[model samples]
Target: MNRQPEPRQAIALKYDGKQAPTLTAKGDDELAEAILKLAREYEVPIYENAELVKVLARMELGDSIPQELYRTLAQIIAFAWQLKGKFPEGFDPDAGPVERDITPPK
Candidate 1:
């Protein structure tokens, strides 16, 4: 019997209010390409943080994304969506229920 090797999963780049991260091209080929492409498509400005990209390259699929990392990615997605990018269309910034007075305005 022959054993198949595990497939490499693409890393999901995250961003923060301090910096925007993205790839150059599409697909899961290379980390840089994917980030640049997504940035361009979404009109999000990428930051000059090489270390971030390096960390992303080291991330493996099925791994739990770090809390800070997740927060950063969420910020980027929100920015893109707000800018009317095709990446996150129709995504509400506040998709959860909000506590507010439902009384009619008098």
Candidate 2:
């Protein structure tokens, strides 16, 4: 039997240089489309990770991400920084962003 795909989901996070990332917005379906449209309009970088979105979408608006997600979220931010060619001094360009681990080892 065929199964329908899950509705699209989007989560937006903002991180200032000194603070942890905070969830700015999130939604599924039509709202997801609107979030993406606004991001596009503002030239925000988009990264696709359904599993990450699933977890992030659970957070309340304006909540900072928990410590456990720091490494993964850092990778995402590093990717955006790379795209803009604005890495901090001594940052290694040859070492690409960390791989996202959907499941952590026990």
Candidate of highest TM-score:
2
TM-score of 2: 0.80
lDDT string, candidate 1, 1-106, tens digits: 8887433323344433344344322223365466566667876565444455455656554344444565555555555555664343444546764354423234
Over the stretch 34-94, how does candidate 2's per-residue lDDT look in tens digits? 9999999998999999998999999999999988998788778877987888786876779
Q: Model 1, residue 60: what's the lDDT?
A: 55
Model 1, residue 82: C-alpha shift (Å): 1.5
- For candidate 2, the 10 contiguous residues with the lowest summed lDDT are 97-106
Query: How close to the true structure is residue 48 of candidate 2, measured as C-alpha lDDT?
Result: 93
The worst-scoring run of ten residues by lDDT in candidate 1 lies at 20-29
Q: Estimate each model's TM-score.
A: 0.36, 0.80
